[model samples]
Target: MSSEKKNKMPLGGIINKGGTCEDYDTGGWRKFRPILDKEKCIDCLICWAMCPDSAIIVEDGKMVGFNLDHCKGCGICDVECPDKVKAIAMIDEKVAKKG
Candidate 1:
């Protein structure tokens, strides 16, 4: 590709800029969302550490909830949580929103 074309493609050919993830509202792309079982949560913070979208909301060192506007509904949180514990559950977006 030409130099001009290469620059337009983005640095290192990455489709998106690094800092833009926080600026973009990618929640619309989600088909599912994570529902937290507060009672079941052990405060392990696995979900917070593994979340690709950084959607896990922590307040005062506790997992509060998610930022639905920024969460893309990726199930990393659900997957990252211990299998036996299963603190986070992925649910259909429509049902999640209704509840």
Candidate 2:
């Protein structure tokens, strides 16, 4: 690759900028979404911590819900939710919309 072409973009298209994905909706490719059962949630914020997309919506130091626009439906939050305290479930996007 030519030096000119090499510097054109960061490796793997990673940008040095912050909050890069927040400006654009990248969840269109997602196949699933996490549904939160607030009743079961203990305000532990484990989902928030494990979410790679930072899609867990938090307000006032409490987890509110998911930001689907950026969630990418990775299901990390659902998996991270303690098994003993499962408060999140990953659902297919189509089924999620129906219900």
* Model 2 alpha-carbon drift over 4 Å, by segment: 1-17
True-structure lDDT of candidate 2: 0.86
lDDT by residue for model 2 over 4-97, one digit each (tens)?
A: 6664667797778897767999788789988999899888988888888888899998889988888899888888898898999988999988
Best by TM-score: 2
lDDT score for residue 3 of model 1: 69
The residue pairs found clashing in candidate 1 are: none
Stretches off by above 4 angstroms in model 1 are: 1-18
Sequence-dependent TM-score of model 1: 0.76
Query: After best superposition, candidate 1 residue 7: deviation in angstroms?
Result: 19
> Candidate 2 has which clashing residue pairs, if any?
none
If scored against the real structure, what TM-score would every candidate get?
0.76, 0.78
Q: By summed lDDT, which 10 consecutive residues of candidate 1 come out lowest?
A: 1-10
Model 1 lDDT tens row, 1-99? 486566355567675546766778999989998889999888889889988888899998899999888898878899889988898888899997788
lDDT of 1 at 28: 91
